[model samples]
Target: MRHARNNELTDRRSAASDAKAALLTAYRAAKTAAEPSRSARQAERISLVEAREARRAERERLKHEEQTRIVTLAAQKQAAIEAAEGAEIEARNSAENARISRVVEDEAARKAERDRRYAARKSRQA
Candidate 1:
């Protein structure tokens, strides 16, 4: 009887060990099955991050281009204003020179007439 009981005890221990091994195998299979889903989720996250970065880069590029265009237009406007001012100054200078020339011609004509009349009077006296 005691030997029979010892055999029964050994059978229970072996059965428990078999059950534990089966549970470990099922856990490993479940983890293996979930691996592909986890990997797919990670890939999707990486793609989303890359897309967001591309959008941000594009926005920055457009903003920089707009700023450059505005600066270029402003520079052109300033140059045009300066050119107009220079033309105005040149016109004023031309007008002043013409007025001075007319005054000089008038003075020379008066002097010539005075000299001619004095010479004629001296010839009559002689």
Candidate 2:
């Protein structure tokens, strides 16, 4: 049943194609006849010019759209990369701060020890 339906569709499509082809041939013959009617010639010229202009405009619109999409995507990717770099820099700064804090603590402990010894010796001498 499916195959029969497909065959029917194919036949219908061919019939339409043939009809279209015949009409096109007849139109061409009428246009080229040794003495074409003034209206027929003018209509053909106007249609051809309009079709060409429409196609040119469509191509320009498609090209502009494609360029805009490419630029927008590139900017988004660049922004993502910058954000990642900023995060890495912030992590490095935090690590350095922690390291410096440890060093400062050790220096303060040494100063306290030195002061305690100096006071003890001066009291014994007095």
Candidate 3:
């Protein structure tokens, strides 16, 4: 009876030890198997982050360029308006000078005719 009991105890202990070793081996194998996939997932996440940053930078650049374009166009439009106003003012001044010149010429002719008539009348009276 003592011998049988001892044998049974030893068998149970051996079986328990084997089960523990098997569980450890399975855990190690699973960790090894998942290592490549885990690293791949991390690399993919890093690439995605980098791509997002690049897109944001591109958007910022585009926005800046658009603003610059808008400012340039506004400045050009203002310059055109100023040039047109200056031309209009010049035209008005030219017209006024021409009218003054015509008035002066007409006054000079009238004065000459009146002086001639006065000289003739004086001769006739003498």
Candidate 4:
């Protein structure tokens, strides 16, 4: 009877080990069968990442261009303002110079008239 019990226990243990081995083989077969689809899914994920990166890069490029445009416009505006101020200053200086020239001409004319009067007086006295 003890030998019979040992035989039964051995049989049960062997059957359980065989079932575990079968389960392991099934898992391996399923993993192999799904490998192609898994790799395809990974490829799809990679492409999506690449597309997202491309969009981000494009957006960054556009933003940079816009900022550059804004900077250029601002610089142009500043230059125009400076040019206008310079023109105004030149006009003011020209006006001041004209006024000074008129004053000097008037002074010279008065001096010449005084000299002529003095000469006439001297000739009359002679």
Number of the top-ranking candidate, with lDDT as the measure? 4
Task: Give the Å error, residue 115, model 4.
Answer: 4.1
Model 3 misplaced stretches (Cα beyond 4 Å): 1-35
TM-score of 1: 0.60
Error of 2 at 48 (Å): 2.3
Q: What lDDT tens digits, residue by residue, belong to model 1 across residues 1-126?
A: 999999999999999999999999999999899999989999999999999999999999999999999999999999999999999999999999999998999888889889888999999999
* TM-score per candidate, chains pooled: 0.60, 0.53, 0.63, 0.65
Q: Model 3, residue 35: what's the lDDT? A: 99
- Please give the clash total of every predicted structure, in order: 0, 0, 0, 0
Residue runs of model 4 more than 4 Å from their true location after superposition: 1-30, 113-126
The residue-level lDDT of candidate 2 at 27 comes to 93
Please give the range of 10 consecutive residues that has the lowest summed lDDT in model 4.
Answer: 106-115
lDDT of 3 by residue, 11-91 (tens): 999999999999999999999999999899999999999999999999999999999999999999999999999999999
Q: Tens digit of lDDT per residue, candidate 4, span 1-91?
A: 9999999999999999999999999999999999999999999999999999999999999999999999999999999999999999999
Positional deviation of 84 in candidate 2, in angstroms?
Answer: 1.7
For model 2 the TM-score comes to 0.53
Total clashes for model 4:
0
Question: Each model's RMSD to truth, in Å?
Answer: 7.2, 15.7, 7.5, 4.4
Ranking by lDDT, best first? 4, 3, 1, 2
lDDT of 2 by residue, 1-126 (tens): 999999999999999999999999999888677355777778899999999999999999999999999999999999999999999999999999999998998888898889889999999999
Q: Is candidate 2 or candidate 3 better by lDDT?
A: 3
